[model samples]
Target: MKFLDQAKVYIRSGDGGAGSVSFRREKFIEMGGPDGGDGGRGGDVWAEAVDGLNTLIDYRYQQHFKAATGGHGMGRLRAGANASDIVLKVPAGTQIFEEDNETLVADLAKVGDRFRIARGGNGGFGNAHFKSSTNRAPRHANPGQPGEERWIWLRLKLIADAGLLGLPNAGKSTLLAAVSAAKPKIADYPFTTLHPQLGVVQVGNHSFVLADIPGLIAGAHEGHGLGTRFLGHVERCAVLLHLIDVTAEDPVAAYRVIRKELKAYSPELAAKPEVIAFNKTDLLSTEAIEDKLKDFKRRVRKTPLLVSGATTMGVPAAMKKLLEVIDASRRGDRPADAPGITTEEWRP
Candidate 1:
């Protein structure tokens, strides 16, 4: 199925059924009292986060969803049948927003999570309910309440333990492919991977999920070069693997550009635990690599790791470090080396 992270949907709850206006008309009874029955309640509209779904492509074709209206009440004190509810199954980590897209209605981050988006209208009372001691028989019945209707937005963000970040052609996909079973598209050119890909990496006795998204360019926060839309996929990651191309001239500058984009998009993302690695080490000579590492250390204020995704060199060490940070994050201990967003409103 095609990937669709965002979709706009129009949803409406079912309207309640009208109450019946009838009297007890028996051949033996001379005076008949009001015996109208109450109407049935309408159906509700709900959203559920279920398994086996990772995309919102299904919502792309169907934009409108309406529940079944309740059945009208019958004569002779016969109640109407209640309408069944409608549930919209969405992927985990899907966030529901109001029409403005700013007000968050629900955050479904786990499987089987459910939220009622619209409530069914209440059923109206029958004529018998309005009958009092002063009035013997009532001729009027109350009408059913109208259902609610509104437009909502659904946004999905993938959940992963770690995320890979880099500029285009910086070998982010290569590292994920080498450590995990995911087969992300790799090419010599830039922007080879347009969609976000997920992988599970194993290090020693533990394994953690990893996500790889398209590279970020300058002014990505302002909608530049695919913008920072895909960044939402990694917002929940405990740590970020920042890869820089060692073959690029002034790799430090390239690193700073991505950092700027991250900070621009969200300070919470910028503050995440970052593990910097100089990729494509096989293409650089020992002397050249040593010099670039020293330059990066001075500029970034931290020692960077050397990893060759193609040759799988120094990848084990990178995975181990990522696992360490992930474990620390899971333990509720925010290590100095890995401080990510903890106060983000929703996973998406």
Candidate 2:
């Protein structure tokens, strides 16, 4: 299935059935009274979050959804059957918005979450309902109310424990592939990964979901490159893993560029706990790695880890640090101290 994070759809509820108009007649009775029954209610339109779905691609094919109309009333005081409701199944983390796309209508963040999108029109009244002592032969009835209709937008934001952030070709994808089962497209060129990718990384007895999004470049918030459109996928992450290519002309500058973009996109994202790492250390010698790590710590004002995504070097340390932050975040006791990296080698 293709990944579709956003989609626009039109929906309408079913109309109510009309009420019946009838009068009872008996051979032995001199006069008979009206006995029309009420019409059935119209069907409703609802949206529900369900399991086994991760994309909104299904909505791309079908944009219009409507509920069944209520059955009309019949003579002899018989009421029509109510129409069945229409339910829309969507993946977890799907957010529903108005046509403008900014007005949030609902956020289906977890499975079994549901919301009503539209209501069916009520059934019309029958002539028998107008009968009274003064007006025994009433002949007027009310029309059924109309159903509601509207156009809405659906946007999906992936849920993950940690998110990877870096510049293009910073080895973000390599790290994800090395530590998890996710097979992201890898290339020496830029923008090799177009969409967001997810993987589950298990370290020791603990496991957490990791998300990797397209790399960010300078001025990404101003529509530069892929822009910050994919950042939404990582908004819910507890911590951010920022990787910088040690071979880059200036690793500190690369780090700063990504930070600037994050702040420009969202303050909350920028404030998330970040673990800095120097990737592609396999290409550098031990001495060179030590020098760069010191420089990074001095300039970035935080301790940085050295890891080689291709060789799976120092990956366990990275994963461990990420899990630490994730656990702290979940308990609402986010560590106030700066993030630190462990140099000791540990196998996953």
Candidate 3:
């Protein structure tokens, strides 16, 4: 189950069957007319979106897909049988592109979505069709048409309600595991989580999907440390959760670095509604945490939530705040939650 978000494959449709050329030669019918049968249409190639799949790794092993060819026509006015179609199942949110990778052919965002990649060739006409009053003994038969073929690219983007953004080892994975059911790899070292993980967070009767993306570095936009390869997964998210490690030497500097990388990768991502959280507060003393919070507020003029993912302290409060932000965002509120609203929004 290696995670693969992109793939390239070649698809070909089946060719039509050839028409039959025969004449009626019965014992009592000496002056019989042509009795050739028409050919059948070729099979088509299609791509469909199905559930229980999250990657395009299946396409890595097999790159070519071809449909069955139509059966040839027989004598005695017998028509050829149509070929079966080839259906390719892919994960939801998969995007189909042409060989150039710029021309979008289809976007499968919902389950049961389907796209016809290649169309089958039409059947050929038989000699009986050309027989007329002036041309009674016609013996001409047309050949089958060629099928269509093309190379396409498939790209998958994870769909979620919220996405977590931060630098390496910023407790993004810890926060995700603390609030949701997802158990992403967590360690003290940087880049412990190399891929994006999804989780569902339920608050009372409401639930929303959250995605924990791989940590980013300073030159992430320029292919540094996993770079912006996973950035596309966050493009569909409705909100962003910016988690900054309060125990870092300079929390403000860490926050700015992630912001710079996000803006460089996609300005639209940086413009998304974000909820800033200061994580790993359990590692700091009460006085030190207060000082860090004061500095964070004075420098950014925004009050961020304080939480400890390891000890689960303030975790419930954090989840409540996130739910409120998600609710406001769904309501299409401009600038969903204002700065310095953390104190008033969090009841616990």
Candidate 2 lDDT, tens digit per residue, 57-169? 99999999999888887777788888898988998888889999999788787788888888788888787888888999776666666788999999999988999999999
Off by over 4 Å in 2: 333-348
Please list all clashing residue pairs in model 2, or write none if there are none.
none
Clashing pairs in 1: none
Question: For all candidates, what are the clash counts?
Answer: 0, 0, 0
Whole-model Cα lDDT per candidate?
A: 0.88, 0.88, 0.85
What range of 10 consecutive residues in model 3 has the weakest lDDT sum? 339-348
Best by lDDT: 1
Q: What's the alpha carbon RMSD for model 1? A: 4.5
User: How many backbone collisions does model 2 have?
Assistant: 0
Q: What RMSD, rounded to one decimal, does every model reach?
A: 4.5, 8.5, 8.8
Q: Cα miss at 139, model 1 (Å)?
A: 1.4
Q: Candidate 3 on 1-348: residue-level lDDT in tens?
A: 799999999999888888888898899878888888888888888888889999999999999999877777777888889899898899888888999998978878767888778888777778888998899988888777879999999999887888988888989899889888898999999999898999998878998888999999899999999999998898877788889999899888888898899999889889988888889998899999889888988998888888888988887787777778788777975453321111111010
> Sorted on TM-score, highest at the top, how do the candidates line up?
1, 2, 3
Q: How well does each candidate superpose onto the true structure, as a TM-score?
A: 0.94, 0.92, 0.89
Sort all candidates by lDDT, best to worst.
1, 2, 3
